[model samples]
Target: MAAGQKLYPRATVKKIVKAHSKCNVSKNVDVMIFLDYVLFMQTLVKEAAIDSKQAGERGISAKSIQKVAPDALSKFKG
Candidate 1:
């Protein structure tokens, strides 16, 4: 994805928020949620990549992701 491109679609994000929140949310709130989601995923992937390298893996694997997911989720949890 390009630097200025959004990883998640705005409509989909808004729909998800509405489904879970049961209310309309402001555009600014949607943007904030989107940023948070993107950052969390980026952090998770980066950490998984580092873990893979440290373990002598040639590339990131699901095992690396699984190992890092719980810690990443907790760190990014609200």
Candidate 2:
């Protein structure tokens, strides 16, 4: 999918996180850190056509992404 398609859903979540606080994180755990970051997870949420579990195994938590994307978060059945 397109990169914008990958990034849009989590836009609000990203904004929320940036507004909250600054964090000091290391690049050694970049993949883990990036996925766990709310903004990044939101990006995954946009790709709902893909299975979320697979994303998590790759370090992107679909469940976490569902939590941050405003639209997904609100309509989430689980």
lDDT of 2 by residue, 1-78 (tens): 866565344455444555664653343343444545665445545554355554545544656455446654444323
TM-score of each: 0.70, 0.21
* Candidate 1 stretches greater than 4 Å from native: 1-19, 22-24
* Weakest 10 consecutive residues of candidate 1 by summed lDDT: 6-15
| Model 2 per-residue lDDT at 73 | 46
lDDT of each: 0.90, 0.50
List the RMSD of every prediction in angstroms.
4.0, 12.5
By summed lDDT, the worst window of 10 consecutive residues in model 2 runs over 24-33
Query: Residue by residue across 1-78, what tens digits does model 1's lDDT show?
Result: 778997668888788889998988887777797689899999999999999999999999999999999999999877
Error of 1 at 23 (Å): 6.8
